[model samples]
Target: MPAAINPPVVLVLGASGLLGRAVHHTLLESLPHGVVVVGTGHSRARGLIPCDVTDETTLREFLAAQAPRVVVNCVAERRPDVVEKEDAKARVLNVRLVEILAEESARLGFYLLHISTDYVFDGTKPPYKPGDDPHPLNAYGEQKLASEKVLRGEDSGERVRPGQGSREEKQGGWDKVWTEVLYGPSADLAESSVTLLARDVLAPLRSSQKKVDDWAARYATHTEDVARVVTAMVDRALTGAGELRGTFHYSSKERSQDLSREEGGEQRPGQGGGRAYTKYSISVLIGEVLGRATKHLEPEASPPEGAPRPQDCELDISALQEALGEEATRSRALRDGLREVLQALAANRMPPPPSSAARLRLLLAGLSARQKSLALPGAFNGLVARAVAHAGFEATYVSGAGVAAGMGLPDVGLAGLEDMTRVIRDVSACSGLPLLADADTGGEGGEGGVRRVVMEYQRAGAAALHVEDQVFPKRCGHLEGKELVPADEFALKVQAAARARDEGQVAGEEGGGNGGLMICARTDARSVVGVEEVIERAKRYVDAGADMIFPEGLCSGDEFLRVSQALKGYNGVNGGEGPYLLANMTEFGKTPLLSVRRMGALGYHATIFPMTLFRWAMRGVLEALEELREGGRVSKTALREGRLLTRQETYELLGYTPGRVWEYPNANAYSRRKGTRRSDFVQEGKEVMEEEDENEASGYGEENPKKK
Candidate 1:
C-alpha cells in the first residue's frame, strides 16, 4: 500500500490586494496537485480570511492552529500618504507584524516568505542588489526596510530604526530573505491608463488608421511570470534542488532595443549614479502589442503626463538567471510577458461583436471542410426563410429564379442588383442560416459592375455568392434559349469578383480582409456550349480565384462526375485542401434530383436544391386559390390546412411573444423574466413591422392574427 500523504498548505497574507489576487489565481491555475493554497486579508471577502495583521494575538493563534507548510507574507502599509500620517500603525502593520510572523514561522517550523520592495534604496542607485545599504527617503520605504531587517535578524530588538533591517539574520541558519520593488499586476506598468488607450485605439484600428509614433521604453514582467518564478523557487527549496535560502533577486529583462541603445546620452543630477543614461519612451511597445497597429501611435520626445517617469529602475537578475538558468529567463521574455497580460485582460474583457466579413469567412471555411452538405433553397421573402430555418437546414440558397417567382415575375433577370440585395438582407435578418446568393453575370456593367455586385452582396451579409457567365438578359438556368458570355469575359468577371472580395471596401466591423467571403464561379456554358466547355470554363474561373465551381445544367450523375474529376487537381483561391464542387439539383431543371449522400459519392462537396421549395409552394398556392374561387373559400383539406402556417407558429418563428408588444399589460414583466430591458426591446417592434412588410410585398404574408 502507498504511504498516506498530507497535502501541503500554502498561506498567502493580504490575499485581497492586487498582487495577492494575481498570485492566488496563478497558483490555483498552475500549482501541483497536492498543494493547497489559502489566502487571508484584513477585511472579509470571498476566498479570503478576515484576520487583521495588526491583531498579533489573533494572527498568532490562527497561524498556530492552521500551521501552514509555507507562509507567504504579502501584507504591508504600502500607501505613502497613509504611512506618512499614521507612522505608528504603519510600524505595527509593516514591521512589527513581520516580526511576529517570523517568530511564528520558527515555532511552527514553516518556511516563512515575505515580499520586500525596491524602494528600500534611495533613487540615487540604479539596479540595487540584495545586499545594498538601506537609504529609504519615505515612511513607506522605511517601514518596508524595517520589516526586512527584523525578518533577517539584522536588528533582533523589538524595535529598530527605519531602513535599518537586512535579511542577514537566520534563527536556525536558514535564510529567509525575499524582497521586491515597484511590484504590480503583470505588464500593468500603465494600469487603467492602458484600458482607456485600448478603447481609443479600437475604433481607429477597425477603420484602417495608419500612424506610427516613435515610442520606446523598458518592459514589465507579467504577474504570472513572477508568480511562476516564486513558485519555482519554492519548489526548489522544498525539493532541495539548490541553494535558494540565501538572498537572491529577480526582475524581468529589458527589451533588446532598449539594451542595444547607448546608455551614455545624458543624465540629470539626483536621477541615478550608475551610468550615463539613454532612457527612451515605450509608446511604440504599447502601440505594437495593445493595438496591433503601430502606425496609429504618435511618438513624443518627452514623457507625457502620468507616463513612466523613472529614468531607469532596471534590476540586475544575473544571480537569479544563473540559479534557474534557462527556466528563469524563459518566462520573462518581454513579448510573451506582454501577451500574458493582454490575454488575462481579454479574459475579463467583453469583445466587440464579430464583423460580417469574419462571420462570412467562418461560414465559408465550414462549408469547405471535407464533409458534404446540401444547400436547400429558401424564398427571398422572410416567410420561407423562417420555414427553412425551422426545418433544421444548415444553409440557405437565395436563388435569383426563386426570388423572381416569389415576386410573381418571370425569371428573365428582371431584378437588379439592389433589388436582390434587399431580398438577401430581409432573409438574412429573419433566418440564422448562412446564405449563398446567386449573382447572375454580376449585373450589366462588365467587370466593374461584377466587382460592385460582389462587394454589395458581402456587405448585405451573404456568406457566399456564385457569379454566373450568362449574357445581359440571362434567363433561368432551367429555361431554354440562354446566351453565354465569352470564356475570357466570364473569367474577367470571376477575377473582378475575387478582387472585390479581397480588396474591396470591407465594412468597418470586419476590418480589411478577403477572408470569410466565398466566391463561386457558375458557368452556364454546359447548355450553350457543352459539358467539355463548362469544365474548361470552370478551370479558368478556378485559376481566377473562385472558391467553388458551380456547373449549371448537368443532365445526369455522369455529367456531374466528369466535371468533378476534371477539377480534381485544382485548389481554391483561399488555399483550401481540395477543390469544391457544387451541383445544382433544381427540380424540373437539366440536373436530376439527387440526394446529398448520392452527390457525395460523385465527388460533389455541395449540392443546391434551388427552386425546389418554391415550385411546391407555387403549386400549393395555385390549388388554394382555385379552392377559394370554386368553394366560396379555401377548402379545409389536408393540403390547404397544412399550407396555412398558424399565427402562433409565425410569431414563434419571428421570435415574437405577445408580451413583446408595448400595449401588453405585462410587457415589462416579460422583459424582466427574460433578463432583458424594455429599452433593448423597443427596436424589436420596428423590425417586426419591417419583416411583415417584406413578406406582404412578396405575397407570402398570411396576416398574423390580431390580439383579443
Candidate 2:
C-alpha cells in the first residue's frame, strides 16, 4: 500500500543555478497539492529570499523559519580557477556549508541532498565505479571531496575536539544517519536537463544505424525520474518509516539496441526482448540521442590540455537500486530526454535576455508608450494575485489600505514598511506582472528613512512605488481629515527615494535596472493647500526624480484633467510622452468612481481599485454571518450564485491539475511508470486490448518476457 504521506514542503538552494532550476521545475510539476516549493537565491529571477548560502546565521534563520522537511542543496563554488584563487571563500561555501547543513539536517530531522561534482575524481582511470577512492587534482575537487567526508562522520574531528564533549554529547552524534552519494549527471545535478547546450557540444555529427566504434568517457541521467525517486525518499523519511539511512550512489541505467534495424523495425523505442541491458559507449549514446551518425561522433582518447576533467567516471548504481527499489532503474530513454532539449532549443533559437529586470523594463515601456493604458490592482495577498493575474491585468498593485484592512486595522499609518513589504513579496510570487506599491510617507520614519523603505520595497519585487506627501499618522486617501506634509519636505523624501533607487541600480540589486524603482510621487495637497499648491507639489515631486505623478483625492474630472495636463512634457523613467498618472477610484471616496475608459480620456495612465475587492469581501462576510445568526444552520441556498470561486476555477488559478493526481494515475503523466508509452486509466476488470496487443507485438508483457 502507498504510504499516507502529505506533500512535503521542500526548499531548493541556489535555485537560479542550472541544476537547481531543473529540480525546482520537477518539484512543481510532480508534487501533489499542499506541497510548497520555496526556491531561494541571490537573483531576482529566483523570486524568493535573496539568500547567500555561505552565511550560516542567515541560512540557519531561514531554515528555522521555513522548517522544511527536505532541503536540496544545489549550491557549489565549482570553478577551479576561482576556488584556487580564493580557497577561503571556497571552503566557506563548499566545505563549511555542508558541515552546517548536516548538523542542521540531523537536528531538524530533514533530509539533505547535497549535490557534489564529478571533479572529485581525477581522470587517471576509465569507468571509475562508485565508492572508488577520490583523487582530486584541483582546489574545486578538494572542496567537494571534503564535503562528502563532512556528511559522514569522517570529518567530525573539529566538532568532537579533545575534552570539549563526549562523542554522544554532541547534538548530531546519533548513529542513525542517512547519507546518499550521486556521481555525474544525476537529474539532481545535470545542467542539460534545464538548458539547451550549444551546438558545439554536439557537432561533427554523422548519422548511422550502427553503434559508434570508439570508446569515450561521458555520463548522463534523466533527472525527471531521479526527482521522483528523491521525492519518494523524502516522503518516507518524513514518515520515519524507511531503513534508507546510509550512503547510496545514483546513475542512469544504460541500454543498447541494434541500431542497424530499419526505420520500420519490428521493435519500437523502449521495447526490449531477450537482450540484456548493457552500458552503451558514450559516443554511441550521444550520437543516438543527438541524431548524429556514429561515424562523425569521435571520442577523445585523452583530456584536453589545461582542462582538468574526469573521463569515464561512470557511477555503479546497484546499491541505489537496492535503496530506492526497482524504480531507480526505470530511467527515461536518452532519446526522449534529448528530444526535450532539442525542442527547447528549436523554440528558443535566439533567446531573448531573460531576467525580472528586463521583463519589467519591457512592461514599463509598453505601459508608458501605449496612450492611456490602464491597470487595476486589487491583490490583497499572493492567492489574490494569482486570481488577478488570471483576470488579465497588465500590472499588479500592493495597496497599503488593503494590507491594513487585511490585518483587521484601519489605514491610519498601521501598515509599517516590513508589513507592506511582506505583502509585496507574497503578491509577487504568485504573479509575473510588474507591481506598483503604495508607500505611506515611506513608512513613518524621519531623515534618510524613505530611502530604506524604497530599497526594501524594491527588494520585495515591487516595480514601482508611490510615496505620498502625508504626515506621520497618514490616513487613507479617500478618508476625511487627512493631513499633508510640507511640499519641500515631501520633495526631499522623494529625492532620497530616487537616490536610493539609483544606488541600487549601480550595485545591481534586485529590481535595479531600466524599469527599476519607479517613483510615483503622490500629493494629498489638494485638500490641505488647494489646487495650485497640489500642482506645484506635483511639479516639484517630478523634479525630485519621480517617475509617475499621482494626484490623490481629486474632487472632479476637470481637476484630474488639469493635473494630467500640467504634468505633460515631463520625461518619466521609460521616456514616455508624459508623466504616467495614477487615479484612485475608492468606494465612498471624494472623487467619483470613473470607468477606465473615461479615466483614460482624461489622460490618466493607470487606475487603481485599491479597497474595492476588500470592501466587497467584507460585505459578503458580514451578510453571511447575519444569515447564520438568523438560521443557525447551513443551506445550499445560503451561498449565492457566483458568491465564491468554484473549486475547479480555484484549482486552475493555483496551477493544480483538474483531478486528484495521487488517485488518478493518468492525471499527471510524470507520475506514470517509466518506459510506459501510453498514459491511461483502466477500469477494474476491463481489458485494454490495444495496449496488450502493443505489448505483445513488442515481445514484452507482465506475464511473459519475449525471446529474441
lDDT of each: 0.60, 0.60
Clashing pairs in 2: 187-223, 206-292, 206-293, 207-293, 208-293
Candidate 2 versus the native: TM-score?
0.47
Instruction: For model 1, state the Cα shift of residue 126 in Å.
Output: 42
Candidate achieving the largest lDDT: 2
* Model 2, span 1-708: residue lDDT tens: 232233356787876665565566666555653456666665233233347687889888778656666787877776677788899988998899887777776666566766676677775673445567888877888888888887765886654321123322222221111112222131111333122222222333336332322332344565555566666655565555552544455655443454323356754433332122222343454445544434543444444444365544555556667666786446666556655544343332211122344334444333333344466667888777766666655567889889988998888888788788888777766665567898888865654678778777776667788888888788777677877888888888888888888777334345443446778899988887787888888888888888788888889999988887777766543343556678888889788888877887787878888877788878988987887888896456755666666798777777566432221111111111121222111212222232333212121122111110
TM-scores for all candidates: the values are 0.46, 0.47
RMSD in angstroms, all models?
A: 21.7, 24.5
Tens digits of per-residue lDDT for model 1, 63-98:
864556677776777666678888897899888888
Q: What is the lDDT of residue 43 in candidate 2?
A: 27
